[model samples]
Target: MAAENIEQENSKVKYLRDKLEKAILEKCPDSRLNGDKENRLPNTTNISFEYIEGEAILLMLDKYGICASSGS
Candidate 1:
């Protein structure tokens, strides 16, 4: 069902977001990021590293073999 697929996708996104958040916090501590921003996508995260260009995040994603959307 369409709804089931959506739910599955959402679950995967949620899991990825959780893992990503923990990793980011640990590996990039003191990276000058937004302290209290929230995830606008259903189950994805958007973090803004203050000193890093946003495009740089794309390079990291590419390094990780992830194909993600850039928010509007």
Candidate 2:
């Protein structure tokens, strides 16, 4: 795809990322990614507040008009 298309896609991605991040930060303040410096993905995430029901967070974004991948 062209840069414009890519930028547009990123726009949507950013919105979802923002929402998810805000929710996670506020709702799960204890969660933090676990790893050394080399194991992390840039602009990526891997956090858990030991949340058992939090997997549904991915689905929550869809209800808010944002589409997102589940980092799979």
Best by TM-score: 1
Candidate number achieving the greatest lDDT relative to the actual structure: 1
- Residue 58, candidate 1: alpha-carbon lDDT: 75
In model 2, which range of ten residues has the least summed lDDT? 33-42
- The parts of candidate 1 lying over 4 Å away from their true place are 31-39, 67-71
lDDT of 1 by residue, 1-72 (tens): 878699788878877877877798778865533334454564655555656666777788889998755454
Across 1-72, the per-residue lDDT of candidate 2 in tens digits comes to: 477587677667666655666787787777665555344434555555555445586578678885556455
- TM-score for each candidate, following the candidate numbering: 0.54, 0.44
TM-score of model 1 relative to the true fold? 0.54
Model 2, runs deviating above 4 Å: 1-3, 33-44, 50-72
